[model samples]
Target: MPFYHKLGKIPQKRHTQFKQPDGSLYHEELFSTIGFDSILSNAYHINPPAKIDSIEKVIVDASPVEWDAGLRPYHFKTKGLKFELDFITGRKPVLFNSDVIMSVCRPESQMDYFYRNATCDELIFVHEGEGMLESNFGFLDFRKGDYIVIPRSITFRLVHKTAPRLLVFESAGPIKTPKRYRNEFGQLLEHSPYCERDIRAPERLFTSSDKGDFIVKVKKENKIYSVHYDFHPFDVIGYDGFYFPWIFNIDDFMPITGKIHMPPPIHQTFEAPGFVVCSFVSRLLDYHPLAVPVPYSHSNVDSDEVLYYADGNFFSRKGIDYASISLHPGGLTHGPHPGTTEAALGKLETVETAVMMDTFKPLKLTNFARELNDENYYLSWKD
Candidate 1:
């Protein structure tokens, strides 16, 4: 395969030196920014001015999308779980044609995220399942949280192989870590503030046996090509680098607060470029004299906002299910369904739950997403 840069037994790479008491640089080739899923886009990217020297402003357009076809997808089925892929654009859904897309993987065991492909960095939200990911970097234990930038080129597998996991994959654009978290110099600031240690990089990369039929799918020219390797991709015994899986737990998020709370900032994590992720964890209502925990209604004149209901009550509207998402496009108004807003205020406290992701770029609704969707979402809140 052309995308297959088979490094043979030894991939061309130098080990990082934090260099050991005994001077030795091993061929630690495993953690090389797994970009196995790198892709060219049909959308336009624009960087707005960064007001805070640390924060960056990026604007994206649907132009990068191959609207003529839409997105592509990957599907898998393990034991306990079923993986379904719904793509917005990649290829015109003409069976087996795609690139730049999304995939949902449902696994049976507490599968070690224990493999890597120098492709497909993931902006993963654990829609279900709990536990940790053991990597060469460290151990990241999380349940139902949004994990962004599990880089493509690195090797990793989920640990505590028990329950199944619901994973979403966006294959077209790179799931970049935020750039503001690092200086132009690449060092995390005491204030840029999340550090490298905060991210769970693998402490030691493990090499796998190349004796099996490893059917790795490689995407090129928007088409997926299957390459059979004599061994598994996780053949590296030990490796290290800036490339690895780092986790930001939703609960660990240090939210910005004031006498009056501020709205969510787009630049929440990154510790990378072109990517910013935030976790909407379970939180107590604000202590303001008068705080409307429920969102107010207004047409978005600026950017498109998307919210994924990961877990919890989502502020009073009952009967909520997992993996529910709401997309309020620009030039449209949305608010607390209807009666919920007024009823919400009467209650002294709320145990609402949700995970929201707002994309500055407008996202078109996929036919599948539109189908599986709770069509009643928009009208459910009505009195």
Candidate 2:
């Protein structure tokens, strides 16, 4: 996050003594990034954050994914994924590279233990169900169409009332709002697609002073390691910083309509070192009298484009329903289906809502990805 946010109570001055009722000092810890040179927050805890009671390393076979056909376009229908009881275990990695890993998770149960990603930022898109994301910073109430952006090393858990389907993107780089959207002072400019007001940060802080062993699963270097803490992980009495988790709903993003269809960059929501995330929300069609409403055919050239269809009718494709993922690899040419362009000409608007991820490097598909793949997708464009 670029802007400053604070929750709970803090001392008037940082690094100063803040005593509890028992005359003991509140433990202060700095959560920082990039060797303490980047965004950071100071959190005051009731107990030392380093007080660990036990440790266990969980071996996960997250081996590198491989493409079955060795680099070609693909269409995967992820609606067939089984419902898993554990949130983390439910995630099935579909496409991945050195920069990002894309997975789908359908959790039938709420998370029992807190979780932290030590090396990567997590962008979880809520496709179904509503939930509350609770963290040390505070609590964020999330609903369907919400994109929960959690920075690395933030201990958090999701509690949902209904079965949740999530599209999870784990990025090795920092996921931030588009740089061009903010000015030198980090304030969102007027022309940005979405403004700062649309960003939902932690609005309330709820601290727990429980004295019991709590397990936190920490993910680092493709492995999940567990540590037991003597005090509750959400014991933060106060915190103020630029780095924290936040939420942005797809429905809140104002689309940029045009006389002529605009490029995909116009829909960008977040940018990182190797990939960019864009939201395709329901918006009016192009107003140009002679415009081809559907996207024009073009070679991907330098990027691998992946689109996850979440809701509504997609104008440029045939037979794809909700939760369909289409991958157009670099060097391949792709566009609207056989008759979609002609059918889109007289349309005034499209109710489609989808998520797109464009990566600089090609992605590899996991073996599990083959289960829902449509082998005939390559021929769908033929008349």
> Highest TM-score: which candidate?
2
> What TM-score number comes out for model 1?
0.64
Candidate 1 residues 84-161, lDDT tens each?
A: 321111111211112223334555443311344333455565666676564333445656653645555333456534
Please list the residue runs of candidate 1 whose C-alpha ends up more than 4 Å from where it truly belongs after superposition: 1-104, 109-119, 130-148, 155-160, 171-177, 187-197, 209-212, 270-276, 316-319, 346-353
Clashes of 2: 0
List the pairs of residues colliding in candidate 2. none
| Tens digit per residue, CA lDDT, model 2, 1-383 | 88999988899999999998899999999998999899999999999998889997555655446756766678999887789876777788999999999999998877878999888899999999888999999999999999999999999998887778999999999999999999998888998999889999999887999988799988888888888997899999999999889999999999998998888998999998899999999999898899878899988799999999999999798878789999999987999988889888978899988999999998889887887799888888778
175: Cα error in model 2, Å? 0.6
The root-mean-square deviation over C-alpha atoms between each candidate and the true structure, in angstroms, is: 12.2, 1.2
TM-score (C-alpha) between model 2 and the true structure: 0.97
- Candidate 2: what lDDT? 0.90
As a whole number from 0 to 100, the lDDT of residue 58 in candidate 2 is 58
How much lDDT does candidate 1 score? 0.43
